[model samples]
Target: MRYTITGGAGFIGSHLAKALVSKGHSVDVIDNLSTGSMSNLDDIKNKISFHKTDILDADSLEGIIQNTDGIFHHAALTSVPESFTRQQEYENVNVNGTENIFKIAKKLHVKVVFASSSSVYGDTKTIPTKESHKLDPINPYGITKLNAEQLATKYLQFFDVVGLRYYNVYGDTMPGAGVISKFYYCIQNNMPLEIDGDGKQLRDFVYIDDVVNATISSMEKNTGSCFINVGSGVATSILELANLFLKYSGSASKIIFKQQDKGNVMTSQADILFAKQLLGWKPQTTLEDWIKNLYKS
Candidate 1:
């Protein structure tokens, strides 16, 4: 089998690309290196074709992605605060770039499993947010993701599309990594861990391996057109996460609280029952286990 992974030099996309190669599938990696790094693909660089092209370049994308069986679309600008400052750029990359992928997929008659986000359900009242939950994104980044999902739906009639609404995904080598990586970095540098607000904000942190597995499964299985939440289905508070880092790293780094950024979602938790039913997937790694393993290694 042949597969194309956009943003394949980035965190989740790189992991997904390596997984495909390990499974004996021919993989083509497309990354502009804007946010993705070549070092992420160093281990398996020789085994796959690397295309240094932006997704917005339809001619280049179509040329490279022509013969692929499917596409794993992970290219996007994902920073919330950054999105607010550069709304048009965020829309251009996150939304317009996605439309380009869908257009190419439609032309090629290939299946597409794209990355969506839990940010779409920004600060929802629902404790365990489901795929059916209302989408009221609080930031430009989230709004672009939601718009991409809408594009997927629009293109679904022409080809198979699966949008995975990823929660806070963390693992080794994450690009623009979120809270987990920040805590780990602080611990490593013996710097104080800064917590935004009261440090009580809740989040569902899914490990990268689980997310990659679910992404591959969504493409391999005949799940049809649908959006599924990919997450550990567990909510961990920021304070607890900080304490975990302190406990595991054996660092005496003080955790200091600061004003939370505007447009930040107070809580996010994914109801992954739909993923389990559709993709036969469940998160196998827990935050505690991952942090503990990090120290062990």
Candidate 2:
């Protein structure tokens, strides 16, 4: 099978591209290098068709995605606070870029597995939120992801679509974009571990491999068009994560409490039981072990 992965040089996208290649599939990658890096694809550079193009450009999408067997749309502006200040850019990339792929995919008649987000769950009081949970995003980033998901629904009449609401994903080569990556960097540098608010807020940190697996599962023929949560189904507080980093890295740096940032979710957990039943997928890595491996001396 031949595959086209948007943002294939990104953290998750690069991993997905490699996974597909390992399975003996041909891959074509389209990425603008906005937040993505080509170095991420170093291991499989020879195995993929790489294009340094923006997802919002329909002409580029038309050229690259044509004749592709499947599409894994991982392109987006993922920053929560960044979206607040750059709402227009977020809309163009996350919403419009998604639309571009769907339009092209419709013409080509291909399956699409796009990356939705768990942030769409917002500050709702629900813990272990299901796919059917009420979505009330308080931030622009979440809103844009939600918009993309909604746009996906409209494109379903043309072709098969699956949207996976990814939880906090962290792993090797992950940039300093998420909490785990930031903490990992600070721990390695012997810098103070910054904690927002009381650090009591909980998050579901799913491993990148697991996320890629769940994403691949959604693209399977057995699973039709639908939205699902890809998460570990376990909650870990911010403080707990920081402490684990300190323990793993042997960092004696004291933790500093900082004012909590805006557009942040206080707690987030996902109900992944349906993902197992539908996609035959489950998170394979445990939090502590993955962390320890990442920080192992």
- Candidate number with greatest TM-score: 1
Candidate 1, 22-115: lDDT as tens digits = 9999999999999999999999999999999998898888888889999999998899989999999999999899999999999999999999
- Assess each prediction's global lDDT (C-alpha) against the native: 0.93, 0.90
**Candidate 1 lDDT (Cα, whole model)?**
0.93
TM-score of each: 0.98, 0.98
Alpha carbon deviation, residue 278, candidate 1 (Å): 0.7
In the range 169-277, model 2's lDDT, one tens digit per residue, is 8888887868888887787787898999999999999999999889877876567789999999999999999999888878898899999999999989999989989
Backbone clashes, candidate 2: 0
Error of 2 at 281 (Å): 1.0
